[model samples]
Target: MLLIGGSVLVGVFTFIYARLVCTFICSLPPAVLARTVGVLTLFHIVLRELLLRFSPLQGERSTPARRAWLLSVVSWSLTGLLAIVIHVTRYPAFPAPSHLKFAVGYWALGGGLLAQVEYLLFERALPPTPTLSPEAQLRERLGRRLIEGYVIFTSVPVLVLMLTLQRFIYELHGDLRYLLEAVVLAAGFTGGALAVAIAYGRSLRRDSEQLLEAVRRVGGGDFQPGAVTSRPDELSLVAAGINEMAGGLQLRERIREAFGRFVSPQVATEFIEKYARHGKTAVLGGSRRNVVVLFSDLRDFTRLSESLEPEVLIEVLNGYFQEMVGAIQRHGGLVDKFIGDAVLAVFGLTEGQGDPAIAAVSASLEMRRRLEAYNARLAERGLHLNSGIGIHAGEAVAGYLGSTDRLEFTVIGHTVNVASRIEGQAREPRPPLLFSEEVARRLGDAFTVKEVDTVALKGVAGEMRLLTVEGEARSVRAA
Candidate 1:
C-alpha cells in the first residue's frame, strides 16, 4: 500500500510539472507533452523501486535518510534541466530568462514536496520499534535536521529571487543603483532568516538541556517525573519517556517498602537487587552458613490473650514486636519472621568481621532494656508484658522456604531448635534471656555470662547448657 501510494503521488506531481512547463509555459504539442510526462514518471518510479528494494533500516533508526530524498529531488530536477538543455540546443530562440526562473522554482518547490510526501508515506508504513533510551534517541541529532531545513527553506528561495532580479536588470541594461537595491534587499532577507534560525536553535538547545537534566535527576535517585513540553517533536517523546521511567522507579520503591513489611528489609533489598541484575532468572536458594539465631516469645501469652480483648491483645503484641525488632535491627540483625506471640530474628546474614553471636547477645540485652521502657508506657493502661529470648550460633540452612506460590526467608537446623528450647528454659527464677553453649564460645570475655541451667532440647543428642548475659566484662565496660 505504501509503495503504490508513494509511487502514484510522485507520478502525479511529475505529470503536473510536465504539463505546466511544456503546455502552459512553453506551449509544446500535446503528443510531445504526454511523452515527456510518461518518461519522467517512469524514471522516478524505477528509482523509487530501487531505493525501496535495497534500503536497510531497522527500528526507529530506519526513518528515511535525508540523502535518499535529496537524491530523488536532484535526479528529477537534473532530468528536467537536461530536457531544457536539449530544447535550447535544437531551437536557439528557446533560451529565455522567464523559462529558467520557472524551471528553478518548480524544481525547488515541486520536487521538494514530492520527496517529502514519499518520506512520510514510507515512515507510516515502517513497523514500530521498541522504545530506545534517551541517550540512544539523542544520538539521532535533531540539530542536523534544523540546519538542513534552514538551508532548504530560507537560503534557496532568497538566492532564486536575487538571481531572477539580477537577470532582469541585465536584460534591461539597468544602472548600478538597481543592482545595489537588489543586493540590499537580499541582505535584509538573509539577516531576518538568520535571526529566526538562531531563535529556533536556542529553543532546541534549551529543550536538550532540560532532557539532560531530567536524566541526571533520575540517575541521582529522584524518581519524580520531569516537566514535558507540548512541542510535536522527538524532544517531546524523550520527555515523555523520562516521565515514564521515573514513574516505574517510583512504583518499584513502593513495592520494596511494602515487601519489607512482609519480610526483612535487608532481604527485600537483596530480592529487588537480584531482580534488577538478573531479571526473571534470579532465584533465592538455600546456603549453609554459620549464623546466630534468636528466638523471643511473650511468656504466658495464652493467659494474657484470654484476659484482654482481641484488639487490645493485638495492640500490645504489635507494640512489643516493634520495640524488639528495632533493638535487633540496631545491632545488624534481620527479623526473619513473626510466629504469633513469638519473634525469630537472624544475625550475620550479611557476613562481616563482627561476631554474629555478640550482635545477637547485644540485641537481647537491648530488647530487655527496651521492654522495661515499654512496660512503663503500658503501666498507664494497667498492663505488663514479659518476653524470653534465646541465642545460639551455629551452621544453618538459610534462604527462602515453602511452596512455589509463597515463600519466607528463614534459618532451619538443630541450631534453631536449640535456641527455642533455651528460650523455653528462661523461666521466672532464671534471667528472662538465655543462650546456648555455642553462643558462649563466641562471646569470649566481651560480656559477663553465668551458667543458667541444662535442658534436653528436641532433635538434639544430649542436654545443652544455657548461659545468661549479666553485663559486659569490667575490662571492656564503659567508664
Candidate 2:
C-alpha cells in the first residue's frame, strides 16, 4: 500500500512538473507536451517502483547515502533524456532555443536534488535492524546524520544554481514575463523543499525523544516493557534488550532468596565470590576446617508429635525452629540441616571477626533465652516445649555429599558425632545445654561452666569429659 501510494504521488508530481516546463519555458505544442508528460509520468512510476522493490538501504550494513545518490541520478537522468528526445522529435522543423535547453537542464538538476532529499527522508523513517550490535547501530545512526547533512548542504547550492541559471536565461532573452514566471517557479520549489525538510526533521526528532525516554526508564529500574512499535527499527531492538536485562535481574533476585533459605548470607556470598573468581565448585569435596558445631534437639518430640494434632504439631515445630534458627544466625552460624526436631548448625565455616567457640556459646545462651520466651507463650495455650543443645569445636570435614542429582552440605567426623551424643545426654533433670572440654577451654572467662562427668562416647578411643553450661536458671521439668 505504501509503495503504491508513493508511486502515485511521484507520478503526479512528475506530470505536473513536465507540463509546467513545456508550457511556460519550452513553448512546445499541446499534443507534444501531453505525450511528453505521459511518458515522464510513466517512467517516474516505473523507476519509483523499482527503487522501492530493490532498495539497497534495507539491511543493517547497507550504505544509505550511496543508494540515495544512485536513485537521484538515475531518476533525473531519465527525465532529462526523455524530455529532450520528445521535444526534438515533435518539433523537428522549429528547433528549441539554447536558453530553453539550459532551463530544462537546470530544472532537471533541481528535481534530482529534491529526489535526493525525499530519499533521505525515506531512509530515516526505516526501522533499525535488531541483529546489529549497539556499536554498529550507533555507527549507522552517525552515517545517516552525515548523509542528511550532505543532502541539506548540497540542496541549497543546487537550488541557488537553478535559480541563477533561470535568471540569466530570462535576462539574456529580454523577456520580463518569463523572468516573473521563473521567479514564481523558484519560490514554489524552494517553499516545497523547506516544508519537506522541516517535516522530516520533526518526525526524526520525535522518534529520538521516545527512544531516549525508554532508555531512561530502563536505567531507573523500570522493567515495564515499552509498547512495541510496528516499525522494524533500532528503537524496538533497544526496548527488547531492556526487557531481557530486567527479566534476568528478577530471576537472579528470586534465586538469591531461595539460596538464603538454605545457607547463611555470608556463606552464600563467599560461594558466589569464589565461583566468580576461581570458576570452580567449592562444595564438591570435603575440606578439613576447625569449625564449632552445635546440635539442638527437642526433648521427647516423638511423644509430643503423637499427642498433638498434626497441624498443631507442625505449627509448633515451625515456630520453634524459627526462633532457634534466628539465634544461630544472629551469632554468625549457618543452620546446616534439620533432622526431625533436631537442628545442626556450624560456626567458623567461613571467615569470622570473632572466635567461633565464643559465637557458638553465645548462640546457645540466646537459644535458651528464646526457648524460655517461647515456652511462656505456649504455656498460655496449655502447651510447652523443651530442647537441648550441645556445642563442640574441633577439626571436621565439611562439604557437599550425595548423588550427582542431589547434594547436602554438612560437617562430619568426631566433632559432629560428639556434639550429637552430648545433646542426647541433656535429658530431664539435667541442664539443657552441654559442651565438650575443648569448648569450655575456648570460652575462657566469657562463660561459667561446670564439669558434668567423664563418659565414653560410642566409636571413640577414650572417655571424654563433658561440662554443663550454667547461667540464668530455667525450668526443664517438661523434659
Candidate 3:
C-alpha cells in the first residue's frame, strides 16, 4: 500500500514535469500520429517488463538477473532510434523545419525522464548492500540500485556529454575537455552516493521491522524459540535477549506450580512472593516475629505409604497438601517448608506483619475449615490423613540462610522452635489450639483463651506458658 501510494504521488509530479518538458522540446503537429504511437508502444513495453517482475514462475528461476538483462536491451533498443526519431518532421509527414528539431529533443527528453524513473524503480527493487544474500540480507537495495543505475547511465552518457561539451563549447573555444570531464565525474559520484544512502536506509527499516515482529510473536505465546537467525544488526541482539527472558519466565512458572503441589494455594502465593521479593527460595536459621505455626501429618501415613506404590503415595500426598495449603493461605499464612510426611506453615508472619498475632489465628481457623472439607472428600476416596497445629506469637528473626548456591528463604530463632515443640506436645485431651504467653498478651481478650500449662520445652531458658483459644477469635482485644 505504501509503495502504491508513493507511486501515485510520483506519477502526479511526473505528469507536471512531462508537460513542462514537452511544452519546450516537442511542439509536434496535430497530424503526427506515428510519433505518439511509437512513444506509447515503448512505454507499454517498459510496463510489460515491470509486470513480469511479480510472476511467481520467474521467482525461483532467475528474475533479477533477467530483469537487469532486459533493462540493457531497452536502453540499446532506444539508442537505435537516435537518428530516425530525430528526423521524423511530424508523425507521417514533414511539416515546418523548426517543428522537427523540437519534436526530436522533446522525444529524447521524455525518453530520458522515463528511463530515469524506470532506473529508480528497478534500483529500489534490489537489495541495498553488497553483503546481502537474497531475502535474508536486510539492506535497502533502492539506494544501491539507484547508484548502479546511475553508474550504468553515466558511463555511456559521460563520454557523449564530454564529446558534446568539447565540440560545442570547450573544443570550439580552444578550451580544455578536463573541465567537462570534471563536471561529469562529480555528478556521477553524487548520484552514486545518493543511491547508496537510500539503499542503506531501506535495508535498516526492513530488518528492524522483521526483528520487532519476531519479538512480539514470541511475547504473544508462540513459545517456539531456537530458530532465530534472521536477526540482522541490533535485531539479533534483541531476539537473543528475549529468548533469555522467556527462559526465566518458564523457570518461575515451574516453581510457581510446584509450590501448589507441596503446599496449599494460599501458602504458595505468599511463599513465592516473599521469596521473590527477598531473592531467595527458602530460608533457615533466623528469628521470626510473634507468629502462629501449623503442622499437618498423616496419622497412619507410614503404614499406608508402605502398602501403596510410589506413584500412589505421591498422588495421595499431593492431593492432601493441595487442599491443606489452600486452606492456610486463604487465612493469610506462608508455607515454611514441607518435610516428608508433614507440612509446616507460618501464619501472622511477613504477610501480616502489622498484626501478625491476629492474622495467625485467622489462618489457623481457616486451615481447620479447609481440613474439614478435605476430610469429607477423602472419605469419598477412602483415604485419610490427619494434621496437628500449634500457634505461638513472639519476637524472632526471619531471613535468608541456606546453601550458598541454592538458598531457601525462611524464619528461624525462638518462635519457630517453640511453635514446633507446641505441635509435638499437642493432644486431644489438652487442646488442639496452643499459644504462648506472648501471643496471649498481644491478642489480649479478643479470644476467650485459657492458660493451658507452663512446660519446659528443650533449649529454652524457662518453662513457657501456653494458652488455648476457646471462642470469639475476634481481631481486636476488648478493654
Candidate 4:
C-alpha cells in the first residue's frame, strides 16, 4: 500500500510540474502525461508482483537458486522492454529521447539493487537450514555467493547500457553534462549499497556473539534461561531452544534431589550409573554376594512406648535412629531399611571393601558407645533405654526385589534371618552385642570376643555357634 500510494503521489506531482514549469522541456499535454504515469505505475506494480511470485525471497518453495535466476531474467527483460518503449516514443519539444531512456534505465537499476538488498535481509532472517553434512554447508555458502554475484553482474550491464545511451545522446548534441550526471549517480548508488552491506554485517556479528556466550553458559551447567531477543527470526528460534534445554536440566536436578530422599546415596548413585549404562534391565537380576548383615533393635520399646507420650517417643526414636544411621554410614555400611525401632544394614553390597565383617564390627562397637551417651541424656529425664545389635557374615542373594510398580534393593537369605535372631539374644543377661561364629572367624582376633553356647536357631538345620564382644556394652566417660 505504501509503495502504491507513493507512486500515485509522485505521478500527480510530475503531472503538475510538466503542465506548469516544464512546458518548454516537456511538450506532452497534461492528459498524455497522466496516461503515461498511470501506465508506468501499473507496470511497476505488475513487475513487482511477478518477481515476488517466482523469487526464492518469498520462501514459499524449494530450489532457491533456480527460482532466483528465473526472477532475475524476467526482471531484466521487463526493464529492457520499458527502455525500448521510452526510446521509441516521440516528444517533439524534448531535446533528446536519450534523457527519458536514461531515466527509465536508472529506475530499473535502482529497483534491482533494492530487490537484492531485500533478498539478503530475508535470507538472513530465515530459520536455520539443516547443514549437518559438510556438503550441505558448502552448498549453502556457495548459493549465497552465487546470488550476490548475480545481483552485481546483472547491475553492471544495465549501467553500461544506460551509459552507452548517454554517450549516444552526447554524440548527437555535443554536450558533456550527461556523462557527468551518470558518474555522480553511479557513485551515489555505490556508496549507498556499501553502507547497507556494512550495517547488515555488523548486526549479524553482534547476534552471533550473543549466541556464543549463551552456549558457553549452558556448557558450564548454568541452567538459568537468559533474556532473549523478540525478533521473529532464526536467532530467536535458537534462543528458544536453548532455554528449553536449560529447563529440562533444571527438572532433572530436581528429580535427583527427590530421589536421594527415598534411597541411600550409594544405592541412588549405583542405580543411576547402572541405568545409564544398561537401561532399565540392569536392576532386574540378582547375584549371590558375600556380605555382612547387621541388625539393631531398641530394647523394651513396646513397654516404653506405653509410658511416654507419642510425641516424646517419636522425638527420642528419631534422635536414636539418626545417630545410629550416621555411625553405620561412616563405616561404609548401607542402611537397607528401618522397621519401627529396628534397623537392617548391610556391607559390601556394591563395592567390596577391605574386610566388610570388620567394618560391621567397628560400626556396631561405635553404636554401643553412642547408645551409652544417649542413655546419659535419657537419665536426665528420669528415663533409661538400651539397644541390641547382631552381626553375621554369609552369602546372600542380593538385588532389586518386589513388583515392577514398587521395587526394593536388598539381601534375602538365611543369613539375614540369623542376624535377626542373634539380635533377639541380646535380651539375655549377657553383652548387648552378639555375632555368629562366621563373623568371629572373619575378625581374626581384631578384638577379643567370647564364644557363647551353641544353639539351634529357628529354621536352621544344626546348632550354630555365637560370640559376644567383651566390654562393648560397658559404660565409658562422656566426652
Q: Which number leads on TM-score?
A: 1
How do all models score by TM-score? Answer: 0.64, 0.55, 0.48, 0.55
lDDT tens digits, residue span 321-425, model 4: 888998898888999888999999998785655678888888888898788888888898888878889888999888888876678878889899999998888
Model 2 misplaced regions, further than 4 Å: 1-232, 262-283, 351-354, 444-453, 468-479
- Candidate 1 has an lDDT of 0.72
Q: In terms of TM-score, which candidate is stronger, 1 or 2?
A: 1
lDDT (Cα) of model 3: 0.57
| Model 2 agreement with the true structure over 190-291: per-residue lDDT tens digits | 668766765655555555556656666766767564734345687677657766776765565566667777776665566556663466754576789999
Off by over 4 Å in 1: 1-182, 276-278, 281-284, 351-353, 472-479
Runs with alpha carbons beyond 4 Å of true place in candidate 3: 1-196, 209-292, 298-314, 347-354, 381-384, 397-410, 444-465, 470-479
Cα deviation at 75, candidate 3, in Å, is 46
Q: Superposing all C-alpha atoms, what RMSD in Å does each candidate have to the true structure?
A: 10.1, 14.1, 15.9, 14.7
Candidate numbers sorted by lDDT from highest down: 1, 2, 4, 3
lDDT of the candidates, in the order given: 0.72, 0.69, 0.57, 0.68
Shift of residue 312 alpha carbon in model 4, Å: 2.5
In lDDT terms, which candidate is top? 1
